[model samples]
Structure formats: structure tokens, C-alpha cells
Target chain A: DAGVTQSPTHLIKTRGQQVTLRCSPKSGHDTVSWYQQALGQGPQFIFQYYEEEERQRGNFPDRFSGHQFPNYSSELNVNALLLGDSALYLCASSWDRGDEQYFGPGTRLTVT
Target chain B: QKEVEQDPGPLSVPEGAIVSLNCTYSNSAFQYFMWYRQYSRKGPELLMYTYSSGNKEDGRFTAQVDKSSKYISLFIRDSQPSDSATYLCAMRERSGSARQLTFGSGTQLTVLP
Candidate 1:
């Protein structure tokens, strides 16, 4: 079974550019969450999507937003990206709130 | 202080030796703890999880949580080189955002073959 899938394994963009990252959750899971992992750091929570709506969010700025589709896949969009936005964007999926979340190979975004 | 603090050790140990990794937290409300291992260019994979204050063992791995001391540990027995990766500690409160996880800077472990 596929654990989780993320698109554009790697991406490169300049400052002020906009980026959209994709994710497909594991089979039988409905919740999708996004995280940002900076170099030499742990993953930081961004927000979580459940039932096509954002149920919870972290300390991230308004620049980060997300959407959950009917099929449980999700997308993370970042606008007016800054140099600090460059990091590995990770997506995780679980059955419900606070369950064991499985992750996918993240999308590495580099801003120049 | 950050909610969770972990040492980023490029900890090196020989194969078949036991390895210990640990983390401390300032959030007393956190009741769930998890350990994840990530290889280069890959997302973290869950290795073990413990709830509140207790110990849980699975095969070659054991997770111990001491709520009194606000510290947690993961012990790996009979380590293998395949176990060489970055280990992250994540914890969350009971009623907070799902995985409102406070993650620690991971520790890079190398099991020499």
C-alpha cells in the first residue's frame, strides 16, 4: 500500500514567487497535514485539513494555506515566498486527529 | 525555552551495540510522545510512540516516558547500519490541534558496520 505521495520531488523558485505542493494520503485515511523542515531542523507543523476544511493551524503566517479534496488529497500553497521559505515541505496523513501519521518523501523547495 | 529540546548528536556507535536517544520537554501538558526516523531526502517514518508516563517495547526498540522528569527516551538494541538516520522526537497535548507537535531538533545516529 502507498503510504503517502508528494509531487515535484524538488522545486526551485526565486523570491516573491508562488508555489503549490501536492499530497495524496495513504489508503483509508482522511486527514492531511503539512509541515516545513528547515535544514538541520525538525519538521514544523503548518496546518491540518479534515473533511475538506482546515480544522487546526500552527504558528505559520497567512502566507501558507491549504486545501483538502474529497478524495483526501491536499495541497499547500505559499504566496510571496521569502528566502526563509526554502525548506523541505512534508505532508503527512492519519485516520483522525492525533493518530499515527504516515509521511511521504517531501518536496524540497529552494529559493534563490 | 522551546517546548521540546533534543541534542543533535552525530552519535556514532558500532554495529550490534545498544544506542540511546533522549529528549526533554517543558510542556507538562504534552501526553503523547513519538519517535520518527528520517533518511536523507525522505520524510520521517514513525519508529515508536508512548502515551503519558510509561514504557513500551517493540522488537528491538523500546520507548520510555518519564512524565515526572519530563523526559523521554528511545533505546535501540542490537543496532544495524540500516538504523543510521536522523531521529526526531515529537510530542503533543491531549486536546490541542492534531499533532500540534512540538518537535525537537533531531539527532543524527550512525551505526558503524
Candidate 2:
């Protein structure tokens, strides 16, 4: 079975610009969650999408948003990127709300 | 203080040596504890998981949780060079719906040949 997959292994964006990262959950998975891992730091929760709607969110601001499609793929959209937004964006998926999540390779976002 | 605290160790040890990694959390509500291993430029891969407290072992990995002390540990026996990676500790509270995980700064472990 294919594991979680993310697009654009790496990306560079300018300040005040927006970027969208894509994710395809592992086969047979239904829920997708996004996380941000800064340099030498563990990942911080961003938000989660289930049933095509946001199920839960972390301490992130409104600029961070996500969507889950019918096929269980997800997209994380960050608007008005800041230098601090430069980090590894990771996508995790689980079969259900309480299941163990599997992560993707992650997209490295650099804000220049 | 942060919810979870872990030593960011660039700890090095010879192959075939036993390695112990640990993390402490201030949140008493967290019931599920997990350890993840991440290689360079890669996302974390789950290594071990324990709920509440006690021990669970799988192959060379043994995970222990002490809810009373709010500390968790992951132990690897006869570690190999391939086991050298950043180990992250993550946990969450019991909930009916999806819950965001709180993680600690990962500890970088290197197993030298």
C-alpha cells in the first residue's frame, strides 16, 4: 500500500505571498492533519480536516487553512507568508479520528 | 514551561549499545504517548506508542509510560547505524474527536559503527 504522499518536495515563496501544499493520504485513510516543524524542533499542530470540513485546529492563526476532498486528499494553504513561516510542512493521515496517523515526506517551505 | 520537554541530544554511541530516550510532559491530561523517528529531510515515522501507563515492546523497541511521573521512555536494544535519527515524543489527551498532538523538541541520536 502506498504511504502518505506530498507534492513539491520543496518550495520557495516571497513575503506577503501565499502558497498551497498538497497531500494524498495513505490508501484506506480518511482524516488528514497538518503540522509545521521548524529547524531543530518537533512538529507543531496546524489543523485537521475530516469529512471535507475542519474537525479541529491548533494554536495557529486564521491565515493557516486546509481542505479535505472526497477522496481523502488534503491541501494546506498559508496566506501572507512570513519569514517565520519557513519550515517543513508535514501531512499526516489516519483511518479515523482515534487512529494512529502516518506522515508524509513533508514539503520544505522557505519564505524569502 | 512548554507542555512537553525533551533533551535535544546529539548523543552518540557505538553500534550494539543500548540507547534510552525520554521525555517529560507537564500536561496531566495527556494519556497517549508516542515516539517517532525522523531521518534527514524526512517526516517522522512512528516507532512506539503506549496508552496511559506501563510498557509495550515490539522487536528491539520498548516503550514505557509512567503517568504518575508524567514521563515516558523509549529504549532500543543493540542499536544499529540505521537507528540513528531524531527521536520525537508526542502525546495527546483522550477525546472522542480528533485532537491535535503536542510534541517535544526531538533528540538527535547517532549510532556510530
lDDT of 2 by residue, B16-44 (tens): 99999999999998988889999999999
For model 1, residues A3-106, the per-residue Cα lDDT tens digits are 89999999999999999999999999999989999999999999999899998998999999999999999999999999999999999899884468888999
Give all TM-scores, in the order shown.
Answer: 0.97, 0.98
lDDT of 2 by residue, A7-92 (tens): 98999999999999999999999999999999999999998898999988888999999888899899999999999999999999
Give, for candidate 1 chain B, the lowest lDDT window spanning 10 residues: B93-102
In order of listing, the candidates' clash counts read: 0, 0
The C-alpha stretches of model 2 lying farther than 4 A from their native spots are none
Candidate maximizing DockQ: 2
Q: In model 1, where do residues sit more than 4 Å from their true spots?
A: none
Q: How well does candidate 1 reproduce the true complex, by DockQ?
A: 0.77
True A-B contacts kept by model 1: 0.76
